[model samples]
Target: MTSRFMLIFAAISGFIFVALGAFGAHVLSKTMGAVEMGWIQTGLEYQAFHTLAILGLAVAMQRRISIWFY
Candidate 1:
């Protein structure tokens, strides 16, 4: 159940990140300067990477592992 929830959350976050990226590229480009757009792009990239990392961690956590390995 927890794994399912985590997967769903990850999907939602990934979708949001894509939407934000598209918005920044198409809509914000008109109003924002190149430097500002670069920052926004960086932020979106970080967010997307973190979201995927969280998804990976959740999957790892669901697996059985020896305490000594940690």
Candidate 2:
């Protein structure tokens, strides 16, 4: 159950990840200040780390817990 939840969570996060990257680059780049954009970038980096960690957990569960965990 946890594995399934993580997989779905990761998928949603991945979508948001791409959307945010595009938004930050194309939209925020023009309107925002450098320091504000830097902070946004930092937060995005942290979010990427956590999303990847969730993906990793899903992979681990597939291998270690059960092949059908997903």
The lDDT leader among the candidates is 2
Residue 2 miss distance in model 2 (angstroms):
3.0
Q: Please, what is the whole-model Cα lDDT of each candidate in the order they appear?
A: 0.83, 0.87
**RMSD of model 1, in Å?**
2.8
What are the per-residue Cα lDDT tens digits for candidate 2 across 1-70?
6778889999999889889989999998999999999998998998899999899988788667554544
Clashing pairs in 1: none
TM-score of candidate 1 against the unseen true structure: 0.80
Candidate 2 residue-wise lDDT at 40 = 89
Model 2, residue 42: distance off in Å is 0.3
In model 1, the runs with Cα more than 4 Å from the true position are 63-70
